[model samples]
Target chain A: MTEREALGRRRRVVAAVVASLLVLGPLAWFWWSSLVPANASVMDMGYPDTGGGPAAASGHGHEPEDGPRVSVATLTGPSGGVPDVELTLTADAGPIEVGGRTVAGYTLNGTSPGPTIEAVVGDLVQVTLVNRSVPDGTTLHWHGVDVPNAEDGVAGVTQDAVPEGGSHVYRFVVEYAGTYWYHSHQVSHAQVRGGLFGALVVRPAAPQEGVEAVAAVHTYGAVPTVNGSTGDLRVDAAAGDRVRVRVVNTGSGVLRAWVPGSGYRLLALDGRDLHDPGRVAEQAVLIGGGGRADLEVTVPDDGSVRVRLGSQSVIVGPADDAPDGDDPRSTLDLLTYGTPTDVGFDPRAVDRRFDYAIGRRPGFVAGRPGLQWTINGHTYPDVPMFVVSEGDVVRMILRNSSGQGHPMHLHGHHLLVLSRDGAPSTGSPWWTDSLELAAGESYEVAFVADNPGVWMDHCHNLPHAQQGLVAHLAYTGVDTPYVLGGDLDNTPE
Target chain B: MKTAYRVLAYLVATGVFVQAGAIAYAWFATLNDLDGGAVIDSDWEGNLGHAMHGIVGTMVIPLLVIALLIVSFFAKFPGAVRYALIILGLLVLQIVLAFVAFGAPVVGALHGANALAILGVSITAAQRVPRSTTTTDASAPANAVA
Candidate 1:
């Protein structure tokens, strides 16, 4: 062939390649990536851990305490909601500083994350919510609760957003208990993101021994947190003491709470007990907003070791693709991610079977297009509440609906995973405060109606909660019309 | 004699587009039907591979062989095709490595590279139609050589 002809052919090849990228290239990508199992790396999403590399915070351990102890209490809005007690919430102003300050925010009780409410399951919660900012009106959503239709906190839907200087008394009989949370259902991404949130732990009737703690999970932009804090955590526990730590995922973040050096046995997730308590040496407890995981840890002979709380990194495998959700291996996280959990409990009987799916969808992450994460066929519902009776032995089959794996967690109730991805995890020495639900993977989680209240089940990644990947598992009062054996969900029989 | 392969390349390109488009269309349609915004927000990249898992997981393995056949016709032993296949081959490798790495940054980087590989395959497949009487390598030198 002539040199000119060869050059012309080369140009054509170049143009073809360009055009193909415009057309066939995307097509090839579609087929190779779309048509085949995702060889795409979970790490390809390129999310930077806010607390430096997760491992930088990995090896911290708690030093033994002599006698000094810090008294940590739940705060609140005028009416208890996501905050321990509900107070007048100030709407957005300039960049409001929360936690240590510097970032823009919305304030509740003059602080970000509103308040932390600590109450027993059966206590009568009397909260007077006062909204002082934003003329558009503000409403408090008792996230993870089964309030009446009129009382259900939705801006325009259930009730009007509390007006500037407007106050509403939120009185709810805390029936179902566990670590549940609340936030403004309206202007969710806006207000909640602005710092109008907190932890709500409804103390269970039969509280376990050792230490009882609350860790609220949420996201600060791309960051995930527990009680709005990352890095080190310490709760006073005597040696060999069975400590039960409660977490309320209020900020729409996933939480991984584990005592790194401590042997944390997962007691419950989503306020439900596991069929078999799976002991995790390096455990990952996934808790979304309104999701809770109870861990029973025997404070080691030593005082404490640092427990890491962060998103799980996915493991890439041969065939270049991760194990699909259906494949048991694919559901596993690549990172040695973990959070300590509660001890095991005896089961009454296998009540029923239900499944849930978690995943991401197209354009889930901004830079990353055509990506998404979801649970079941849906992610978390952006609605104010999910209605149900209290005290029911619920079995949720958690399936990771999207490509990303999520650490599924629940609020207000700790649950035990009866199975992972539909197979029996019960026999796998099951006990977990949180467990990993890989992409397209599912797990069968079971628990009793011991804790009666509204609960949340969602991915434990803090940001996931803010984006509305949070679901509510409501437990109405036993006297309610929707009783489980009768209505199939009320707290007590 | 080699011209026959040119026609085949054109056919293959056309086929890839059709299949990819069909898959994309299905994905778009399914996404549209659900309240994706309420839950997943708005991202489609993660879904494509997952939605295609059934076809990709089951069919792609077999197609790898066919893709190999197509590659064989275009270039000499393992040079061009091997380059493109490297990214494709990373799928299985990633899963295994993740198990070892515990989902750390090393595994993360490999995943990022695989995504780049997917992008490379798409570009190469589209550009193939115009080249003739030239060694058609599916991957760039960096991709191919590595």
Candidate 2:
């Protein structure tokens, strides 16, 4: 080979090597840049150097401009025994965005899942529901409301589904407090799944200070509103202030939860007080349908805490809180503007604990997704029936192995949950019916085997409950004739 | 004279490997950004990790393959041809062994066989090549008089 040719070849090789190096340098940079997780905890991402670069024209990303806003903070109400509540529901039944797609829904005030109803124990609630959607109207059934006999929403029994554009007013007293929800009486699966149900947080008669709650709306049809998982709302307090967090699973799936970075101790569940509240420290509270727990959690050090929402989080921080009764400040406080709250979870304080499992049973004969609910892998029966013995410290472990959610209901009795999603509901404790248990979720509740006779534990979606997803929690009785249901004529014998 | 070029070529190939390693590392770190579960940490960490996977997965592996090729090619010195082919054969065997050994009860046996083959042939090739030892025969003249 000629010397010139050799020299040229060498030069070409050198060029290729340099080119490769140049290419690798940028590729390395690109690789390094992308390696960081999208959600890497930026809490410690280098502190902003506040005054560096000549700030460019600010409007970079078309960030949504915050407009007229409102916050949900403190709510004041006249003190009394509020066992029942009533409201006129004008359901604007129509198509709405759920899971990003528009689908039919039973919305109150043009919103799916209705409005959030906050009430305390000993209050009477009267609701008049006007269904303006489906060809066949609907009846209002408080999924987990502690109400009277006549007001029970059973189609053809309690009252025929108020015809379309028809109205029915339900009046009942709030017997307990906790995380309860409401939905249609019959054919509710289709409607509630389409957006008819909502959160009903019943607080204690003497509410705990700095305790707050938010009804997290879960819908596959709708993207999300506020709380990503347990719903959205925040509370702020100075260090040592007891912070209560009540989680209500309103979707058709078992909801798993934890405080993420925050810590707290659980106190009670299902409205049933604890034999010893200290057990909540190490106890994992799992609330079945119609259950509630009071958690006692101290605020963390000044900074921000992102409440883990399954796979996401809602940022909670130590910021200024609204003075005594500033409405807007209260609302903004719900969005996490609160002062330092020095509170730590006392693992020894939890007095009660139970085991709940979330599992699914596949039928070899069937191909479709089968019934998904909780309570020891058993689906609730259509005609509610149960067998229970007295003197049993009823520790009910609700394991939802199914793909859908079931809000188990205990007719006459209430149980208390010490923790939720393996985390305790710090300070906020109340009672009610219809605790929403999401799919693949588990909850633990304990109650005295006190309420005799057969009680109902089933999905709140009346249709799902009606379709054999109901169970009977019956207490044994040999002294007299064991009768079930408040009115025999309305319920099947 | 030609050896100088070969030596330089080997250095270039080695550089490619280091660069590839850096690329692979980048991909490993960004996995979470891909909206993929925390292949590392599953939290609110968003989906950028996956979006950058293309750069790491695509750009790095090819460069390493080229480096390996260069390394294999230069493995052509005195006994390099025979030694390289044997080593190459063992490499292929190890790859096959790795596949067969996966989830198999005979994994330990397969691994032992792979190590033996690589070591036996490599030693044989070394024996055939000129050694730097004092008793070396090939590098010195068989007959000093000639």
Candidate 3:
């Protein structure tokens, strides 16, 4: 070819190359900036701050030194003395009977719903957990109790999982009188679903005279059961006897509990008593997953009062008087059920506010293909780090648009439900560690940052959490020495 | 011979554009997947992005094969042969860069940058094809090495 022609062709090629780079350079920069911020690394997303010690406050864990004096190592329980009430719980994995169905599961003390340990307020409750045959090991996490960081029982975080034939003692004072439960924290997705949980009811110092029954509802092999019984759990009650049914939902979904033949009052929720609970009839109380509700009902004159849990019944009187057919009653709305009372702190003066919108999108997680649950439109590891200083009154708005219900459970602290959707709560103070969110529902909950630790706030649906529906509520100065996905295989969900 | 060269160039250029489109789609899918904060069911989007990337990346193998066949058989089109070889070399480089990206994600930027160059060069090569042998002879030497 001619020299001039070759030069012109080369010039055109150079011009095209320059033009392409000019266009693509800016686009690449924009994409990089959007996906990875300039100052933040992928490590900032969910990796534990490995710097260690109290001086390693990098604004991620624990507030600055000038902030509130929130000690992370301090225990919330009583300072001294051996545990007043001691109990032993042995975890075993084998075929167990649940609601008449023999299924492979892990159980506590040879039973799915382990023995209910009763104690009075002001007593120190100590439970020695012995891992008998659980291959992956086990650690008991008091689901709603705000114990010290060391006693939280998150495997790899607070402490290592108790291997087979090993034991761990959890000692904490019963400061509050209400219904609570404990479950395995190691590989909890499979352990909790396979049983390995039990009820813990702490009564008031001056106990009231009544017929008390604990109805621990769970789904075994897909069969709904109340107190491990599939059918009616009969509790003999004389006429005029006041019955208090502590309904604890241990399943991964919301459960509806109601008295079919009598009116009842909701006394407490999540271990906290409601103020001036008025009587209500013909409505079922909805309890979120991992939540508890205490209902009071007086036995009828002639027949029985049946407290229906899910599809099963807890007959307070004679089973012959139990009503048949479906309960056509409407569900009760707890947001406006009882008389309003003081919540102590004003929710109006919130220090920090955050909106956590739960959504779902098709994507990949660690190379696996599926639809993933998301918080605020981002998947796990990329989820929000809700930072707060100690003593700060924080308000969080949870919105679910995922077309599915999520029982969101927050660790280390309980929150007061302020409103549902947009309506303000007018009932007695409703506190919850696990809040249920229906599809297209929004709830606003507020809580003080009293517990200074890196807490996990995730869906109670363990499988959903395994798929990535998890986030962290991080205090400024508290850093976790734990590493997820390490050699321990710690699946905290 | 001129028509055969034209067809092969057009196919290579089309492959380049298709690969570019696939990469762009994958990039956006990855963005959507990453933006899905704490969602449990959002993994499919990321998997689809990787699938598109794999499908498009594998497409280059067949495209390079066709270009090689054109150069081997159509000895008259020397210019088209050179362009085909350059494209084949770039495809190999792209594959290497992609593997390197797994270890050092920062290299992904270079992988993306190289993709634009491949697209541009393929298009330029396609545009250089002569409409007829009379025009081709005027622009190039006779009996050119393929």
Candidate 4:
């Protein structure tokens, strides 16, 4: 062979080697950086975002110079008290009947929506979760209940997941009367979607005269259902009777509820009653994922009133059949719906302010490549740790530039909506645990840091949370004993 | 190396056709569902066709294009690197257009057009490999001595 040919061959080999390195180098780095340690503490996982607060805050525990440290395990409710409401729920992995099609899902006591646990305000509720056959383990999270930190039931954050053949007890007092829910927090994204949830209703202390029904909506596979049934929820009521329907959105997206043939009043949101809510005929209430709306309607003397919940409906009146109505073109604006009243504390007197700006970009999360959700422009394990102190009035601005909507849920506390899109709330103060933010929409909300614990603030679309659209509302001096992705495989999505 | 480049390039071209077919099926299925009283709200996570389109567009085709680029360097074909680079650039633009289409749906037209550009360039890259392979086969005896 000629010398020139040999030189050309050598150069080609070198070029190929260099090109391969150029292609493979960054991919290797991304995969390596995305690897999360099996047993890692949430305290050390991400960077601390102090929300412009003092770095050496007085009560913070991790600083080592603080007064005292409180482990998350010891933040329990009264342990040795007689419980007013007690129930044992057995969680098993099995088939759930959705529209007569048996789909593989988890169940409690052999049923999907389980049993509705009802209690009165000021009553102590004790729930024992017995894991019978679930392979990955499970824990029950009180959706809207402001239980103690130990009773919050977040696996890997507040407590360990109950393994198969094991049991865990959760005890807490029912402080407020509202519509709430309980679902497994371990592998929550998959387990909650697969029917491991039930409704929790707490009635007020005063005696009320009305017909009440809890309509917990969930989607089993492709079929949307209300109270584990595929068809409309039929409530037999006499003419001129008032039916109060509590609609709880347990699924992954926003649900619209409207009553046709009769005017309805949105009595409550999340779990708190609104102040002087007026009647509306054509407007529909938008319930974010993991949110609740209580609707009251007085049945007309003519026929049935159908409470349309998107595809599903709640039929209330004397007749069996109610014509389905088209969905309302406009949603009921909560910002201007009811009369304003005192919400106890002032929202302008804020202690610490935080900005949660959500966006989306192509990136790697846990070693997988896709268009991933981001919190404050950072992905999972690199997200913000929103630090706060007990008794502090915390104001947060939630902005969604993520090209889609997100139902943001903050555990252990409820936020009062102060403003939306820079417009102050002109109606009743909106109290909610799950606030839905559409693309390019922003909201300013405030809440008191009454419940002290490590809490999850994240998108309630379970799959989105699993994709790392999560942050934490951590109180000062609170630390958890458990770690994520540990020996027990605690995946608290 | 020549064969690997050709196979990867053709696979990328085939992926464009699959993406088009899957997106078409997704819209048609959505229309059928809407007719059957299904509400297409924020809760709707699309049908199986949409899932196929997402997986192929994001994961499958991008990997194929990267492999084709690496193989082009060692394939010993004229303009092989240039064609691979052009296809890669088009694929990157295609993804950007897809994301932009989410907020402004009119950009979807550009996304569709870019997919055709990727298909044409990748096919051109694959077609060029065979002619170079024929030339190499004829000169195989001289290279064997080296």
Q: Which candidate has the top score in DockQ?
A: 4
Give a tens-digit lDDT track for model 4, residues A1-493: 6998678678768867887788789978876777777887777666777776665543333455655668889999889989999999999999888887889999999998988999999999999999999999999999999999899988999999999999999999999999999999999988999999999999999977879899999887668899999898998888888888999999988898988656899999999999899989877888999999999988778888899987898999888877677877779999998989998898888889999999988778888777878888888878888888888888999999988889999999999999999999999889999999988999999999999888999899999999899888888777788889887898989
Interface RMSDs of the predictions, in order, are 12.1, 17.9, 15.0, 5.0
Model 1 CAPRI rating: incorrect
Listed models, DockQ each: 0.04, 0.02, 0.03, 0.35
Q: What is the TM-score of chain B alone in each candidate?
A: 0.36, 0.37, 0.70, 0.89
Ranking by TM-score: 4, 3, 1, 2
Over the full model, what C-alpha lDDT does candidate 3 score relative to the true structure? 0.72
Candidate 2 per-residue lDDT over residues A13-120, each given as its tens digit: 565456446545764553453232322111112121111122122111233434321111111122344335656777766777643456556676577667777777
Rank order (by lDDT, best first) = 4, 3, 1, 2
Candidate 2 stretches with Cα past 4 Å from truth are: A1-86, A98-101, A222-240, A273-296, A318-408, A415-455, A459-467, A471-493, B1-146
List TM-scores for all candidates, in order. Answer: 0.46, 0.44, 0.69, 0.93
How far off is model 2, as Cα RMSD? 23.7
Candidate 3 CAPRI category: incorrect
Candidate 1: list runs displaced more than 4 Å: A1-101, A134-137, A143-152, A155-157, A204-211, A217-219, A222-243, A249-254, A272-290, A296-306, A310-398, A406-418, A425-436, A444-493, B1-146
Stretches of candidate 3 exceeding 4 Å from the true structure: A1-44, A47-79, A318-321, B1-146
Error of 1 at A404 (Å): 1.5
Best by TM-score: 4
The local lDDT score (0 to 100) that residue A356 gets in candidate 2 is: 37
lDDT by residue (B17-54, candidate 3, tens digit) is 77667777776765674485312221122345456666
